[model samples]
Target chain A: MNLRRTTTATALLAAALASVAAPGWSDTLRLQGYYDYVDLQLGLQLPTVVVPGEPTPFGLFAENAGPGTADYPVLLLSGGNNMQIEGVSGCTSLELPQRTCALAPLVANWAHVLRFRFHLEPFSRGIVVFGAALTSEAVDTNPGNELQVVSIPIVAEAETRVAFVDVVPETLVDGRLAWTVRVDNDGPSAAISPFVYNASWAYGGLVDVQCTSNGTASCPDQMNYLGPGSGWNIRLVAPPLSVDNPEIQVGYGVQPQEASNAFDNDGVWLVYRDAFFRDGFE
Target chain B: MAAVEGLMRGPRGLASFARAFGAACGGPLPALAAMLILQCHATTAPWSFVVMVVLALPAWWRDDGARLSLVDASALAIALAFAVSGLGPGWRFDGANAVPVAGFVALVLLARHARQGDAARVVALLAVVALLQLVPALVAYTRTGDPSLALRDAAVPWLVVPNDLAWMACAWPWWIALARERAGATRIAIVALLALQLVAFVLFGSRIAIAAAAVGTGYALLRDARGRWIGAGALGLAAAATFALGKGVASLEARMELWRAAWSLFVANPVFGLGAHGFVAGYREWMPAIPVDPRVTPWPHSLPLELLAQWGVVGFVAVALALVASWRSARGRRGRYALAPVAIAFALVACVEASAMRLWVWMFAALLLAWPRLDEGQEGTEAP
Candidate 1:
């Protein structure tokens, strides 16, 4: 009985010690940071107008005349800022350039289509602009004498930059696990497809990669491209018989081809991995 | 002299066999037989099959002429029906399989023995069982490094969380009764065992269990004082204070959510429920789009609500009726040893932390069989 008791005591002591000395007994601590850029684009659509008769109206008038009518006299004209005119005026009687005109006119009993072009800068991040115009040059303005003004709204958002530092202990085997990390997204524009990859020493074979768009996935098999802010887990299995010190490294960058780095093309980003050991069976 | 001795010994082997057969053939025989059949289908363990066959042999042999009351018969019938249903549904023959069968057997045994005025022995057996449960619980707590959290998790795998608490609550009164009736060494052992169980219960950090212990202890004390009205008033005040102080507000909130889910299930299928273990599937079907994390299990964490959601009004009403009957029988002891535990069990169940079906059946069985026989009662009065 005494021998049995001694053996039991020794076994229990060994078991306890073994638990304290187990590998991968530490908690992985993580510190993450990211930088990103964004670009905005806008387009405009125009409306069309029609006339009832070939009779040339007052103010601005465009007409289609036979080649023989090259010397037609100008009847009315009007001009404005940021406007250009271009079209084939077959009226040789009209004293005008071949395909260019500025606030020109047309002869009576002639019909033609008028085209106008306006150039406005419409892309801004933190600012907005709105404006309008009127068309008094056309007679009876097809439906009615109308004031046509273009109101364009432009907005610009400022870009952002972020950075942080973290410290994680290595005594989690017999203690509570805790860590603190700093995160920043200094923004003129939101980072598109931002992500952070974290790897740890105890389970050094597998890497946990997470993105803003997708959840965690194992790493090193094939890079899972989560479109603009996604992440996935990446698993890495080591050889059956191998021994190495458990360590951690982290690397992160924007997803390729997802976002334009127009705002902060020359920016650097950093991510960190820290861990501690704890002595407990979970 | 040898001839005379032989005559006196007379047919010992045959008598023993006859007695064993009579006990086996009692009303519990069919239920035991059904349990064995179900166990055969449920477990893959060769040893369990052997054990079941061995246990059932006595019941099978004695099943013919053993007398049983109507209540015992009905209880057996209900248990058999449930076992058959569970077998049909393909519930695995494992740890989960043993819960209802063990509960049924315990009830049958308790009721049989209690009605014969063997209450002391029954109570003693229960105390021993409660003490035994403490070993694994302690081991789990120590190994996990978080005693309370470990107890909570262990409760699930063991199916003993709230049930163990109820058993402990019940054991307290039995210990007290034993100590009062049989003093000296027996009383000391009982007291020590009860104290140990109480310590383990407290360390478990089961809010409902702790509350039940407090209530049971207070009721026992009040019973000894013969201050039933004072006890009632104190209990009311305590409940009021708990509610006013918001001590149980979080649990109450969780109860309300479960109640809502139960109500919705009842509204959709007023009969037969969605099916056993069907509350989650049903909830998913009718659950409104709420912006919150999803729950994995269908158990609303409230026993009554879970019952209503899974079994519909019929099963719920039957269970409620059974509880009422058991509570009524226990209350006849007039807030004595049995009454306090019953009250504590009811309180825990009302808190929506534990199911009372198993405990209620067991308590009822004990009440029916263990109450003092009229002759014993008279003898006791004469002795005093």
Candidate 2:
């Protein structure tokens, strides 16, 4: 009787110690109901606003929140309009609209990250809604978490509409002849790396070249760029008011190589004589 | 004798004084701190956390000589779970379960020795806080002429998510119960406070909160003969309000996406959750493909989902056990009558909002478990 009691007590103590020592094992022992549930969760990260026809990169962040390991976890990426899969990383299949990644065996409390690159066809405007779903060997108790759906707004290609807006003559503090050459960016987007290149010129080169804009009192970085509905003014001191070269002809055009409305992109301004001439005796 | 007396006059005396002060203040402090936290939008201040630690200290000073009840055990388990989950790689003591765990501990200490009067004082204070919150809210409403905008503007320099204030106000039923026990001026005052809370609720315009309040208050009041009509009216009004605000289908969709993200987090670590504020960091990895702003909804929005996502299955079990224990402890006729509304209100709010990690919310839950029976005779007496 004494021996039996001792054995019983010793066994109970060992079991209790084991339960306390290994939490995972104890959890499994206590709740066998969820032993087979493989909760594979799939998520995707991509830029919400993307330029069409450009190679855009996105990533798949996958996790197996499981009490059970997922031996065959597959990621299904699809439901995107006008999206073409240019390249993929960590995925097995290259199928359009519905690409599958047969991930490695994902045990409980483990994660797998995969990346992909795709391009949206040009002229694809409005919103594009895409979805990704996860499937594994074991059952996901909550299907709501296993799938992710996201929307991206496709923005049209940025058009830099750079055009010359009338030049005005002004007298400087030193009584020097100056012309304010105004340029307007009547754009629906921003002017990237915009510049007033001297396409053609005559007589002496421009002196005291200072730039200003409506956005700021002075141009930011030599008028490197202009926002939509903004104006940039390049103030040039009139060349030395000489009789030998009576007219200062300045020709310039704004660039992006191409403009949505290129008609007024370049303008030629002829300052006959000088501000002294324009004042009365032209 | 001289040496002992000298020692008493020194640091030891100060220590004793502090302990006495902490013990004396512990019962009302949780309620007071919760009130301030709920009313004030800024929680980054260290005062609330300091109060929690001070309140919890007295539990270690003198033995209350009371055996640990199932409710007490479960509550302690919750704190332990929170603390344990906070451990591991890059574990910092700040920003996760620190305050909540301290809150749970202090709640346990408060419960061990709190009397009916203490409970009453806490409830009364909470009601007063609710009334005070109404003033600014009303002023904003008068200016904005829109309840939602009013609530938002009133909480200037401090962002008040509509759901947060609405969740806090879910305790209106408890205030109503307290008012029923009063007479004349006190009763009228409590009634007036409830009215203000109702107005504040309307101004806040959180559909989830409105629905939770309606369910909790309606259930509590509909049982009484005098309050039956009022309860029915309230239920009708709440239903109508929810329906009217049902145009927020986008909000609901956003919540669904948030829930999905939380679910993904849970699946990633099913047994031991990501630990306190883990979802805040991890959800980015599992963000839904939708063009949803993560900053707008930092929390999972669902308490159960958050628990699963952050604390994992272990934390979830601890909470489940605590709920069972609370139900058992408050199953008596009078206890049920007193505790049911608060419990129901909080539970309903928890279903749709991240109320679990909030210190005030935990304090309210503690109040639910610690509240004394109304028939225990006058205010200040300890339960036999």
Candidate 3:
């Protein structure tokens, strides 16, 4: 496998060297009054939409549609102010704030591609336009085909972390189970929509559900939008009978409308039950 | 010239037969090439390339080289510009790169062929290709029973999207006007074809397409001195209709933001500009908060601005020179006025869509470059 990889790399290097050494030759089959033509077409490939805080891969491609070589070709990088661009392979910085991916002379029917990855700002939203241009010393036959622009729509996003707090009962014989479910908006942005949660008991009815912020008042079925770094806690109480090994499950989920980047905390829950109280042993 | 004339006379048997066959097939050959381009599933457009090479074979054999006029030279320059834009960083090749070069080559061949043969017949054949786009629409309608779906989604898997389909519709009125002196039955058929095109234009719901049709048709009407008022009325009606049906100012606002972003890219490099890929990156930095259609993002959505933004002034000059030269070359031709509406509609639509790179656009350009001169006495009267 290593040998094959080495062979492929060697072939590519040789080709690149050959292209740099002899970029183009004047056409011998030119019709009368026809000057040598060099047509270069530029293209780009990237996902149209991207999530904030994630690396997005993109490629810029250029091809010489020529009867001659494109001389002194340079690929210029522009735009993407909302993104942190990285892994810009095969390019050199020619000017401050303007990185140019310079290439050797590109012969007829040959193409060059520059692949890179860009990460959107953690709290960024709206569209991000990435632009690359192919400029050469020679006048191109078709300029419209020489510049590529790719737009990536980076959506407004946030992350919500759910924490389960288990509290010891006052006494084992009390037959009481209590736990707290806390949700924090560990976000780059505010959650703009509601986060809905449900409290269900398998063998015992939910005795009481209280919002700690409201001093033991009933908790709403859904929590309103929370700003970045904000949190909410829901405390649940249930009673266990000796004959019944009761269990309590507090499930929660956030809709996509909540500015959430990922669904990691979606449709998740924690279960609580007391075995000693169920068996009447303590 | 003498050598070619002698060769033509000397070929008396099989070679003569082959030349005759080639000549017979030549008029419809470009249309066949276009059909291949439209039908090809892959972006490479390999089959169309083969057909173009084959279509140009007769012209090559005749050796009756057409003069490379200023218009042709400018067009070639534009093609070169397109080619050089593809020369970037790493050595690679793909369909996106190959198809455009092939398209430009096909444009050259078609121009040469049109200069030598009946240009009108080739156009009629193109009309035939356009009409054939409806077959799939019919099949879609049969399966789903929804005209909108048939026009928009159904044809996509098999042929063009609704926007391209609408672009094709822009040609109907011009073709109908060109065939005005035909027989009664043929005129009726042409009318029916025009109706179908209008239906496609309306049902496809491509705002750009509808506007293009309005402008193109309105222009044709306005040119006829007697119908000037009608043209004005038509434009007003179209505006009213758009407001009533469209998503209104919001969509227009989106396009405005996109154009502003593109203009910023153009200003950043007024000379060579950023290469094609500069728009997306530049747009984010310059106009980060603007909302735009994900489908139309990165593209200026306006052809002229896209050219300026990507290729800068040099690219704009190349295209402008070609347009002026083509206009000059096409002067004095019979029914040259018929081209006005088509050109107007095409330009207007391109202002809201990146249609400059489409194969059909190139084909239209080739036709214009090859448009017959008046002195040639080759104006066709056949109905489409």
Candidate 4:
């Protein structure tokens, strides 16, 4: 047993060592922007939400993680949208010129992490540059800090997010379970082919499936909506003796509508049996 | 029954599947809980983990000596409240709490059969996973010039972030309180782990998490009236700091409006809540603070308020009973007292973050119920 512990410890140490070994890789510095910083628990970042006309000065943060002092910071822009760098230390170009004049190198200094500050920017779609190259004009001995580029992929995320609002299945007095499900768009654009089903009951043929949209059972295609709360409502009567805790799924994948990340494509629920009384095992 | 009937025709029958499924889930739940605590991929990870636990239900039911404990009974009570609430108009019958409740029960049962050294080993194993989480982020940062790589491809394979590291840091009060129990490598590992958590908190900029850690640490360090004072002070400081960290006056205003909405919802349906997942609509429809367009926000952003709004008084009472029972168990028992501070920190985190339905929160909560007061020498692994 001690040997096993030692061996496991040894493996972990090796993995940790391996992870930090490539200290001077070209990607040593992190180039952070506005959209790059948005971290959501159940959501993904897509570039489709940049609104034009507003002077939305996007954020740009150059983080230094290398062993030595790095300098020279530059901001590059491409893509049809005109963007400007505001209140940045090294940006001397004042928003024009692909490469900005280098200010006194930020000591090329950073402590492995930094947070981005939000600002106004004239909305546009294209690329922004970051990294060690932006830090200094001199050749960085550490190639690890190379110039990096990113694009806020132009998307209509407002339309993509669709989710199963609720999937409540109740046990009836007759021992049969009654299920109701609702879908919500919660995004900017309307959903085209919104589909909702009991993912757990994959063997659809075995179960006697009866479902409806807007109380109309057997609508050829499920309901679609252009805004929040506009999607379809489904009522289901599950086959007798279905298993407890079934997983129900909802998503929109018909034409003109795409899922918002994988999240919009799938919302799941765990259906419990009528678990009110004692020994409510279900 | 059908699967059992088919299996009963054979010799081992269902017990065999229970043991097999139990083995598969037992090893990963703690590690996954650790992930759920710290990462944005929390929802996905727990959903996947619960599938494993749910599959093992047959085992939990058939396994002798695994009857419902105080924790289970109270958990069921809370669930029944949600059931009762479902009979109303607003409350939902999603049984969202069942995942965490049942998962906790399964884990406790698994621990009962653990060997003498399993408790220490379990801690060690979970600690290793916590440390290993850095690899993907570090490697991703190196390969791509993005520090938030942990958020993007961070949980690609693991179904999970640095905040997760902070979430794992929530356990430090327990470790720091118990660190002296070991010497040499174990001690060194404990210290290193705590330092890493501190560093992660500083770098992550998750003010709420840092405050939660401070609560846990302060409690562990003081452990008495002074500690309680320090915790209250920390809570006050956290509230101030969190409010300060707000984007501007709008966020504070929004928070006030949000709080008011939560209160109003609770007042309106003080008996039961709008439902388990009713906050999305409640926030949009009733919340006068926001513009228009009422979308989904999942929970009420505060765990206690979420409970009041979702399951209403019954859930609150059940949760309160479970907490008191666990506290009593921790105090009455020897080694378990150390978990109190950590649990308190979890409660504090709920104030800033929504986690009533989070599997990781409940997993640790349940694990604390089953935790041994001391692993050095114990009669058995079961809770007293």
Query: Model 2: per-residue lDDT, tens digit, A1-282?
Result: 343223223322332333234423312211122213456677678887765556778898778776457767777777476777643666655455456667777887788888887666654546667777876732222121377888887664544333334454566676456666666655444455565575434365555555654545446346555555666676656555554445665555566332332323445445455533444455
Off by over 4 Å in 3: A1-282, B1-16, B25-45, B86-95, B115-117, B141-161, B225-237, B277-282, B290-298, B372-376, B379-384
Model 3 over residues B1-384: C-alpha lDDT tens digits?
Answer: 333444567655556656555665454354445544443332323344444545554544453443556755676567556544434221123233334434443454345444433444555565666666666675776676665446433433223345665556466455656566466876787777766766665555556666776787677767667667977776777776556566666667777888888798778777655664445435545564536543324346688887777667777888888788767765655543256567677777677764443545555655544453311345443111
Candidate 4 on B1-384: residue-level lDDT in tens? 444454665666676655555554444334334433333332233334334334433433334552445654554465466566664456443333344444444444444333344455556655665566655555555576544454455542221223334456567665654455578888998888877755555554456567777777676656555456765665566567545555355534555566667777888788777766565446545676443323224445577887787777877887798777666555545442356666677777667553454544555665665564223244322223
- Candidate 1 has a DockQ of 0.01
The C-alpha stretches of model 2 lying farther than 4 A from their native spots are A1-282, B1-45, B52-62, B86-97, B136-159, B284-287, B291-296, B372-384
Cα RMSD, model 3 = 18.3
Model 1 lDDT tens row, B1-384: 333444457686556555545454333333333332222211211123233334444433333324544434344443343333332221222232233334443334323322223445555655554555565566677788665345443432222333335446544545666677788998898888767765665565455544555465557556555546655664565455344444456556555666677678766665545444445445544444651323322345566665566556655655555455444443334312454444455456455654322323233333433232211221231110
Q: Which stretches of candidate 1 lie above 4 Å from their native place?
A: A1-282, B1-70, B73-110, B113-117, B147-149, B152-164, B226-248, B284-298, B320-344, B356-384
Query: Which RMSD values do the candidates have, in order?
Result: 35.8, 19.6, 18.3, 33.8
Better of 1 and 3 by TM-score: 3
* Candidate 3, A227-253: lDDT as tens digits: 568767766666753355455565655
Give the 10-residue window scoring lowest on summed lDDT in candidate 4 chain A.
Answer: A33-42
| Candidate scoring better on lDDT of 2 and 3 | 2
Chain A TM-score by candidate, in order:
0.26, 0.45, 0.51, 0.32
lDDT by residue (tens digit), candidate 2, B1-384: 343444479887766666556555544455345434543433222344343444434433344443556766677677667766675221234433354454444454345545446556666777666655567767888898876466555652122345655644577776677777778898899887766766666666667777877887897788778899999998898889888865557767777788888898888887777776566556656776653543324467788998888778888998888878767765543532266666777788787774454545665666665554222233321111
Q: What is the interface RMSD of each candidate, in Å?
A: 25.4, 16.3, 18.9, 17.4
